[model samples]
Target chain A: MAVVCFMVTMGLYFAATISFLAYLLRRSEALSKVSLGITAAGFVAHTVALVARMVGSSAAAPPSVHEALSFFSWMLILVFLAVEFRHRIHVLGSFIVPLALVSLISAAALPDTVPTLQPMFRTLWLHVTLSMLGTVGFAVAFVAGVMYLIQDRLLKSKRFNVLYSKLPALDFLDDLNQQSIILGFPLLTLGIITGAISAEFAKGAYVSWNPEQTWALVTWLFYFVVLLGRLTVGWRAKRAAYLTVIGFAGVILTLIGVVLKSYGTVS
Target chain B: MHVIVVGLSHKTAPVEIREKLAVPGSRMGEALTRLTSYSGVKEGVLLSTCNRVEVYSVVDDIEQGYGRIQEFLADTHLSLSSEQLTPHLYWHADDRAITHLFRVAASLDSMIVGESQILGQLKDAFESALSHKTTGLIMNKVVKKAISVAKRVRTETKIAEMAVSVSYAAVELAKKIFSDLGQRTVLLVGAGEMAKLAAQHLIAQGVGQVRITTRTPQHAVDLAEKFGGTAVPFEQYKDDMASADIVLVSTGASHYLISADDVQRAVTVRMNRPMFLIDISVPRNIDPAVRHVDNAFLFDIDDLKQRVEKNRAERLQEADKAEQLVVEEVGVLREWMKSLEVTPTIVALKQRADEIKRSELDKTLGRLAHLPAQDRELIEGLAASIVNKMIHGTMVTLKSEVNSSNGAAFVESARRFFSLEAAPPQDTRGESAVDSSSCLAHDMNAPLVEQVPSRTASRKQP
Candidate 1:
């Protein structure tokens, strides 16, 4: 049931991608709605697959790497649907669906190992979930930033093609980028605080500031400066978009580094 | 009844010739009446707009109808002789005439295809023709079907969705740049006519605020009042740039008015929020270098014109789909028209048969004058029954062949064989015989049951 659900979710995302691409090529409003419907269906199937995985588990263990990746992709889709609803930027699906598809496919390829929960962070599932949400938010911001730059380049070059017509306005994309940052920063801050508290309550546990941890701090501070600069120095548009991309890159690199660093302990 | 269309549009005539032939608004009733007064014309409609002048009519004979309408065209515009005007006027007969009328009503033949103005113009023309009492059964059906077909074209195709005018194109582009224009400020830097038109379009789109600034302060005040906006001093316009989302510059300046450095300053002040700068002046009021400024997009009149051209091309592509839809609808209408061919033949044959029966019965009664009145009545009844039976077989044959491709030829052959040419066709002109509602009811009661309309049967009012 779980495998079938995963395949169906993947198929829907692929269909949504084609629909969105067709809209971009034709600048069709009807195709945009079709793409939105397909993506929403894929989101539902993805949510069902996640629930099935949880129900299939024994409940006493922590999520494995593959499960965490699956949950992260689900978070991304959930955030995308919310942004799509609020902004009505159906064309953004053409850019974001491939990312969701790749992450889900990667998760599906990984072995479904049921590992015992770590003693120190067994009760810290809330922190992990919050951090996933934060990263998902940042990923959304990354997509918006990329879209802004493309639109900005097209406008500057004065090449009004189908892609240029399909993209949202520069101002709207910039605003969406700001919104994602606003939603992600506080969630990341709370997740970090909760993780620290959980580590402190565990006996003989010391929260070490490893290189990956330090990198995560730098990513948080980078977004902090971006938000602060937007408020004080009025940094926006191209500069803001570039800074958002850098911040998201920081988050991804830190995540990969931490996962690899802890690979030896997973067994 | 035969349908005929005679007209010249933008395609066939230049503006000078079109203007000469255009019937004035006050003279429309006169024109329609004069058209129907012509020989062989039973019902007529005159459609005269700035783009085209056309006459639609139901007539007794197609050849004589075309000749009369062409003479009327020559007479309406005395400046042009019949010899010169013949090349400009086009005539369509029968089903082709109805198809032409539908295309015009649907705006396919318009200078700008898919425009909504032509539909209203057609309705106005129809209203004038109806009030003049020159439209009869055939024209009534033609007008209603044209209107419904126009509505269908609008709903089924994307031809009418894109903007073809420059001002409308500017508004569409602004909407693309800012998802909601209701919160964006528009700064008009000049009070030119084009600028006023663009401002009106923006206002129609429900923009937040419009500020006008011009060298002529009074003109600025007047334009502001016209659009219900605020007037700002020309010098202070630069100060309002930071607050404005769109800047329209169309001053008749010989040199560039707004420079790149000025736009850069505005961008800095507005926190790099995206700005659209439109320069619609001949000499170009805003410097083209302003496009290089971060978050500042500048478009001149040429760019907007190019956008309009591209949009027009897109609409043209959509018109291909609209034309296909029209072809399908015309085919349906043609089938309905073809079925009416059998009606006239049926009426003629029955009239001829009854006349023969009456003449022979009268002769027989005269020769047997000594016979009683009851014997004469029985002889007359027997004659009528034989006529009815003979016509019934012919009516059944005609009805069965109505759907065949050669059904019309068969009807004509039958009419010739029965010597029905001497009999006149039923004349229901200048009456509310085929009013659309009753026509639909008649269609519901037809032999084909939902396919062909019973036009001839229901086309007799009271």
Candidate 2:
């Protein structure tokens, strides 16, 4: 049932992505509406499947890394849908659905192995959930940043392409990017703090110089600089967007480092 | 309905002409009343703005409406002749007018594309007309739909998101240098309209202070009072220029208002802190070479206009999305209209046929009273089947022909051929006869007489 639900959700995500692209090309409102509807339905189905798996499992918490990742991706979709509902930002779906699809596919392809829940690893769940949520928030910010940069470039270069035409304006995108960063940065800070605490609890150390931890700290520092630049130097929209993209790169590096380290340890 | 638009805009008319043609706020009610009273006009709305004055109206006779409007303008203004104004007047008919109104309401046709002022202007015009009851059903529907389309374009597409205006562009540029304008100070030179507009925008962005300087102290004082700022002496303008973060100069002076030397002095005094200077004057108030100064940015009218033009082009491109939306909506509306046209005729035809069946069944039953009950029921079923087969082809023809251009004529012909007028007007209060008949066909086991018209003469005698 879990596998079937994952497949169905992946299919829905693919359909939603195609429909969104169709809306971009053909500029059809009906297609846009249908795309949003399908994505919402997929989120619901994926949620039900996750709950079913949780109930069937004998584990006290999430069974494995793969299951945790799948749940995290589902949470991202739920958050995205809620935002879209409140803001009525149909264009964001163009960015979000593809990311959701990638995450879903990755979750499904990962090996299904039940890991023993060590007391320390149990504490790490909070760290993982917080970091994942923060990363998702940053992903949304990155999308907004990319849109701002493209719009800025178009305005500067005086070439208005179809994609440029479809995007929100530079100021609105700038505000959206700033808001996303403001919301995500705190969550990320908490994630790092909790991870440090969890590492101390598990290994009797307050801080570890692991590459994942180091990169996470570096990512946090990047956002800190962005906030300072925004406050002191009054960093303009384009510069801020560039900084967001760089920060997102740090996030990606941290995720990869953590995954590779986990794999190495298990082997 | 024929549509005609006659007026001048910023492109075709000078400020003098535009101002003269502008309908003052006090005169709007009277203007709307007079416009609707003109001959051949079915409905009318007048859009009067500082940049443009246009009258949008539907009429039975386009030429007559156009002439009357021209004459009305001549009579109101008293000095301008119809011939003199005719060159500036533009006329669009039918689809062209509809497309023009939609584009204008969407701000795609504005001097600055995607400028939101036009939407408000259109709403004001609609409301004014509504107050006077000058707008008819056609204009009401068209204008309401146009407003919805404008909103959809703004929300669904990215047309209205950016700074397409020069004043707004200046503020956006300021944001690029300083993320937050709340701590910055803005200085206005010469109290020009453009400068005032830029000052208003800066204030809205949370600029901490505003100072206005003009060659005429009273003018500067007036502008300062309006924007809740302070007026400074014109001679002290150079001294204050160093203290200000952003300076906007739009004066009518032929000579440069802020020379390169003036900026160099200010830059040195301010310790090379970044300063933005915008010169919107026609002849260029600030020296273009000042842009060469280290950390001192000077943008002339041309540069700002170029950016605005780029934004306008981008907005136009985005308009394709809005256009696609409009096309789809229009298609749906046209389909609904066609369906409404066909329904009434189908109902009338079905009622007439049902009445004929009931009368014939009654006469046959009277003659067959001596037959057994089961055999009578069998004969009645056969009669009903024959009636259904006979009407099937006619029904098909009616449904097919009802939505054609000559649909009304076809319906008229069918009504006459069937003598449907004598059928006691079958329950026009209920659903259409076609729908009722389909429901009847689906439930064939039910009594057929319930679906048929009762005898009209028996009801009249009672």
- Per-residue CA lDDT of model 1 for A1-267, tens digit only, reads 777888899899889878877887895789988888998899898888888878998665666656777788878777778778887777788878877886777676666563312546655676677777788878888988999999889877767798888888887888888888889889998877777777678744435687877898889899899999987888888999999998988998987775665454564
Model 2 chain B worst lDDT run, 10 consecutive residues: B433-442
lDDT by residue for model 2 (B74-100), tens? 766767777777787777755567667
DockQ of 2: 0.02
For candidate 2, please provide the TM-score of chain A on its own: 0.91
Leading candidate by lDDT: 1
After superposition, the stretches of candidate 2 with alpha carbons farther than 4 Å from their true spots are: A22-31, A61-63, A114-119, A160-166, A169-171, A232-236, B1-188, B191-212, B224-249, B253-279, B285-462
**Residues A40-133, candidate 2, lDDT per residue (tens digit)?**
8888778878887877776545346677567667876776788777767677788878877877776676665633223375556677677777
lDDT, candidate 2, at A68: 58
**CAPRI tier of model 2:** incorrect
Q: How well does each candidate superpose onto the true structure, as a TM-score?
A: 0.57, 0.47
Q: How many Å off is the CA of B99 in candidate 2?
A: 32
The lDDT, on a scale of 0 to 1, for candidate 1 is: 0.75
Q: What level of docking quality does candidate 1 show?
A: acceptable
lDDT, residue B374, model 2? 93
